[model samples]
Target: MMAHSPGDTAFLPSLPQLLIDDAVRAALREDLGRAGDITTNATIAEDAKATAILSSREMGTVCGTGFARAAFALIDPALKFEALVRDGEKVSPGEKLARVTGNARAILSAERVALNYMMHLSGIATYTARFVDLVNETKARVCDTRKTIPGMRAFAKYAVKCGGGANHRFGLDDAILIKDNHIAVAGGVTNAIEAARAYAGHLVKIEIEVDGLAQFEEALAAKADVILLDNMGPELLEKAVGINAGRAILEASGGIGFDTIKAVAQTGVDYISTSKITMAAPTLDIGLDIEIA
Candidate 1:
């Protein structure tokens, strides 16, 4: 069973088991390739059994224990995988998060892929946690954009939620977000919103992205459900907030970082979206140590 953290229950939904299993299977297949752990197959006896501990080398939030277990199971169905902690739980250095016991060859072969998922997902969670902490006192909520890795979108966004950030659109089809190019093609903000309304169902909300106050006013006049304030500095954001006067949900996007997020949050926007948390977060340091008996 997957562990759930109380802090993440609101933002993180239950992920589909089939999807996670398929992803892990693909990753294991990729690693196994043609030869398939030749070193392990040659060095270890086929019947040899061993135990391994997956431990964090640094402090961070955990987000991919399920994926790690799936990887081991895919490698060898009989492998015993125990998750010591659930996804979204925080951990410190020297903390053992999971234990795997199985055929020595299976354990060795699955180690790298399992560690890769856990470390990368945990890193995203940790990075997002910093932003969430910085803006905890503010009315604004932190969220992630569609700028996620191609196949890893589900896992990456899951980690973001684990770190206390919300998710924007799951995909392009999920909502109507009128970006700069959409505006340019549609002739203006109002036109884009109108066209989107006609193109989408009534349930689809119109979120128009504006580069400055001029477009902000147009989007506001058009009554957008959500307005994305793109690349606006603190001054402009403050002015935009004032002009908005609670007219719509304002989202601060574009190039936001740790140093600027607090100031952005202070501007009183409804949501702050950043791609750095998912795109560039450094992998958390985690390792697997094996013991053969």
Candidate 2:
């Protein structure tokens, strides 16, 4: 089953078996290509029985264990998958998170696909947790942006939540954000804000992106619900906040790094969004060592 979103009450007791099936199927087709597992086919009996443990090679948060198990379970329903650690729990190098024992071919076939998603998603969660930790004592909440892998945004956002970060719009439909290009196209901030408010549904909030204090004041004058103060240093951000005076939700964007995030948080923005969290987060170091037992 997919891990529940943080604070989510809804439970996904089991994923549609098809998600696991399709992901594994595509992975196997890619890895096998035209040759199949040549070494396994050549050297090992098709029905060879084996037992293996899933152990971590680095200290980090555990994620996607269920999905990893789902990968193997898809290959062999009776494959023993015992998860010794829960998703989102901290783990150490050499710690055993799960054990799988079943047909050797099934275990070998599912290995790579299982490791790919687990490592990738866990990396996202780990890095997000880092940013979350950076601002734990402050008022700002770490958030992830649209800079996500194309087909895996939902899973990526799920990982962000697992790491104590919140998700922005899953896509364009959920929010209306007017940027520099839109302001230029519409002739000015006034035109852009007016057009957005007019064209948007009542429930669709309007946020305007401004690059400097002048634009911020214009945006506040235009009555934007959220003002994305782009690349503003803490001093300017403070000035912008004083200008805004609680009339809108203040969001800080651009120039955000671990060194600068806490100071930006101190600038009194409600949230800080960054593509760096997703684009720059390295894949967590994780591996599966399979041995016959």
Candidate 3:
């Protein structure tokens, strides 16, 4: 499958089942440990069955329904997990996101893991949506950084898309991003871009981070595919935009918040990347309530 870019907002694709299965399996193993859901084993009868509903307790976007379904299916194939709403859809309080029916013990065993993925991902989606909404009127798109939980980058990025945000390079291998450290090691911005250009294949696009107008001018001269305007407030960003005159894709990043995003977007940057979407997002509150039937 082709990687989703910051511009692809209309169609949100599901992650590969193999990837989902691998992640869900590891989580289940971590949670189950050596003995496995002992509390459920000790309390619930083996043959007992029950129904449960996964409901949102607060307003937010929904994500990770597939992961939640995988959690239940992996625990017990007999469990029937049904998604009431797809990922990227908004939900209000008391909305049911999914329903699970089957062995009561399996439902109980998988509940926490399911909720973990959904709640965490939904949080990122909700937070990203806020940023996206803030910049809706502008040409700038909100994008996510790699500041995600170590093993959860793919899942987190997917959630960002669900919330209407764009994605930056998934990893170092996908694109050439010359940061300050890379430039320092290479001796200068021009040298760094030259080195990356020589080494990277034609399919790769080169992007460089610049802190000042001088460096931005150098990057523009180097014909970098994308230029990251780091930590430039509204005034500086506007100046950078004016200087560019549509030479390359301009991205404004660094310390951008809800209050200032609109101003940043208004400066006419193509994208705004932030770590807050993945790092500082609050988990959306969701719960599984066992049906009394």
Candidate 4:
């Protein structure tokens, strides 16, 4: 079994501190508002100190502990934040993930924002882990799509990595992915591949999406670096693999779910990209329980 300790980012590269701080501050702002945790301020003594336990209510792969810590730091610089489990570690129900000791009001104020990051990101990691585990024996690897929350792409993709999945292009500018629309606009699959290859330079690898064998052949003939096999059933995908013969990197995508992913993986595609890992992951049940000491 692998262990993830506090600040252990070995599963994936940590997101920039600036980005994490900005996001944490924004969440704190929204949570605090103009009144600033009115309930805590009204009921809790300003000078009171307390301890809060970050615990999991269900089994999941832990993530975003650092982000949660940042939330507390933004709320009160004096708060003592400690992570018991590292990111990417599988946790069981009732597990104590971390602890924060500091100003009671600050702890109460940071509770929601902290738990929100842990729960949401852990959900993505857990869900992606399921998909990754299913296809572990296959030649294909699970990957995440670009369908992520507007401001949380980096965080969501990081969770995917924690779950043992690979990441596709982080953004449109990161790589050239010519999809159906790009093909239609360019008049054909071959044209789209050709145009992408011409525009993208050696630094970029052009991947084109093809819905069927004809377009697959066209893209192959155009010497695309990678090919996306979109929405094709196992039979078609196997045929595509047979025809492809390793000429380019084959990615199976579109409507992939737990029920169909195994079959899709057996087709010998190099990658399986899905939106569910990021866009549809269910947030894990986690909470912060504060106890004054």
Candidate 5:
């Protein structure tokens, strides 16, 4: 079997610092492939100087300003980038995010790459904030799912944190989350639960995802420390919470959306995770504008 990549916690991943550096480097490489800003070379004179202002085109929680600056630095170390708004700061349309000034061509060249990271990361932050707000009054906290862009998990997860949602896990190796498939392969929930309890070391907690009350009951009976009540409706989830009775923590997941999340949160699950928080969230509409100075 092909090995799964690094830092995947079975539940959810926390950002590992080393991996963050790697992601930033890789993203810069993609933006600055061979040929190095041909458009800038052809038009803007080398000695010319200009300033640019990064601004928002829509309301959002700002994020990745440092990374965006780092992206420009990688392109040209002499570049001067200043942040007008810190990551996690809320900004409305037309608000200034940052200022950049250096070699005109270099600034022009680094524009797209820097803006790409800023916009993409801010999008995740923006959506995460919404979900977090939706469930703020309830006991449950908003969490991001494994449904993240491949190779951009850390960036997305970071934005989620910036927006006030907690991360689930980074990759499979970090945690032991036994879902429905594992139960089927192991013969039953009890069997899977037993296997996990028997095999995992003392520090590892066992979590299982179950689709219905029967499976949940089996998980509860088997003593799973964390029970993922997948796709269970509000009424069923309340029963699940009652059944857990302060034993296992319950997470309500599967097909959750903005319309239904508040209701799900009211069901008493300890947490609610959804892909809609990241996947398909529109870019927060930030842009970099040249300010000739």
Candidate 6:
């Protein structure tokens, strides 16, 4: 993980090279299948060389450059991949993002896999940025939830950071989040909180979800480190904040979209976690155009 920058809220620490290489290698393996780029091998000579330019077709925040580079490098180590803009930077339509110069066959083989990562991750970053922009004036920070595509949680969460949003717990093991289901299973909010508190190490902070004021009071009395106000509208959220009185970190979640996020932020919650940033984001249109020379 990269160090947080106080000045650039959108600054993202680079993902570990090993993780990037592993993901890219898997994607390339899947794409290549039993035989590798048969079309390229049949049509383009192995000695053929060319330059390909990656350009954005729509305005969006850029991400996953390292993944793209890894794709090309793993395909052919001699290939040169240069990123014109860093991850987390905003780009306009038709803006050139990266240039790849080397064996034409290698570029062709890696194109789709590279674009697949860039487009999907950039879309998440773009969507997350919109939510971040809407809530910029408030104390509330936009956050990404666990509702991510399986096997891609880390990438999705990294995209959220690129878009100027904070990440929630990466997985269930990282933190103890007592949701309504947990509360019900444990008999009550107080019971769940107490059980979690007793089981958790001193470094682990416990967060509980509550839908109404009564549950909120129980969670507060139980001394949960963080309280999630689930599906509550602005009015109820504001009231919850008043009830909280700085005793715990407050997060408002559920049914939050671009339309309602601003209102929710103004309710004085510390964070707003939504799945739309990752699950519902459309792929940003980016294309790779080869310039054979």
**Candidate 1: global Cα-lDDT?**
0.89
lDDT of 2 by residue, 66-132 (tens): 6788788876798898888776666778888788888888888778878888888778877877787
Which pairs, if any, clash in model 1?
Answer: none
Question: Can you write out model 1's per-residue Cα lDDT over 165-207, one digit (the tens) per residue?
Answer: 8889999889988999988988998888888878888898889
- Alpha-carbon RMSD, each predicted model: 2.4, 3.1, 2.6, 2.9, 6.2, 2.3
Please count the clashing residue pairs in each candidate, in the order shown.
0, 0, 0, 1, 11, 0
Scored by Cα lDDT, where does model 2 land? 0.79
Q: What tens digits encode model 3's per-residue C-alpha lDDT throughout 1-293?
A: 22223467456657999999999999999999999999999999999999999999999988899999999999999899999999988899999999999999999999999999999999999999889888887889999998889999999999998888888989878998999999999999999999999999999999999999999999999999999999999999999999999999999999989998999999999999999999999999999999995
- Spell out the clash pairs found in candidate 6: none
Off by over 4 Å in 6: 1-11
How high is each candidate's TM-score? 0.94, 0.89, 0.96, 0.95, 0.91, 0.96
- Per-residue CA lDDT of model 4 for 18-136, tens digit only, reads 98999999999988888888888899999998998999999989989989999999989999999999888899999999999989888888999998999999999999888988887
Least accurate stretch of 10 residues (summed lDDT) in model 5?
1-10
- Error in Å for residue 206 of model 3: 0.5
Task: Between candidates 4 and 5, name the one with more favorable TM-score.
Answer: 4
Q: Which scores better on lDDT, 2 or 6?
A: 6
- lDDT, candidate 3, at 134: 87
lDDT against the true structure, per candidate, is 0.89, 0.79, 0.92, 0.89, 0.82, 0.92
Candidate 4 yields a Cα-based lDDT of 0.89
